[model samples]
Target: MEFQATLGQIVTAVIGAGLQLRYLEEYPEPFWRPGDLSAAAWRGRLPNAFALVASRPG
Candidate 1:
């Protein structure tokens, strides 16, 4: 598989597109536990995962 954009690049592109960044977080391994598959539980469990919340201006 080929690599694409990095997290920073993504954020930059989002902002450039006129979206407002509300929340941004990096989910490291320590933030999760085994057998945690729920949305709130699996956030930091997966590898190379991040939580980014953005929205367009009203």
Candidate 2:
């Protein structure tokens, strides 16, 4: 899938994550953020998996 978001969001998220982890952060927003992306900000940062299972309304 393609990646979305302007350069600002990318920069902000990266910097925030970096400061939070005290390292150079480099990871996409976890869980969900439009496009299907995989990122690793700080070391030991757990990433979600493929084929998400969601429940439907009755």
Candidate 3:
């Protein structure tokens, strides 16, 4: 079975793996789309995806 993790859990896992947390950005829209959609259409909706940036310690 597959296990889903919360955002905090994922971030913590990354930190535990020796990566320094840099930044994270939550996206309002999904990367894959079923049809054409406008930015205005996503304004009040919840985020469907996010982008995270981390770097390994030098």
Best by TM-score: 3
Error of 2 at 17 (Å): 0.5
**Regions of candidate 2 where Cα sits further than 4 Å from its true position:** 1-3, 19-58
Q: Which one wins by lDDT: 2 or 3?
A: 3
Tens-digit per-residue lDDT, 1-58, candidate 3: 9997878998999999999989998877776665666565355377768889999989
CA lDDT scores, all candidates in order:
0.77, 0.42, 0.81
Task: Single out the weakest 10-residue window by summed lDDT for candidate 3.
Answer: 35-44
Candidates sorted by lDDT, descending order? 3, 1, 2
Q: Against the true structure, candidate 3 has what lDDT?
A: 0.81
Q: lDDT (0-100) at residue 35 of candidate 2? A: 54
lDDT of 2 by residue, 1-58 (tens): 9986654565567555543323333343345545554345322265322222223223
| Angstrom error at residue 10, model 3 | 0.9
lDDT at position 57, candidate 3: 87
Cα error of candidate 2 at position 13, Å: 0.5
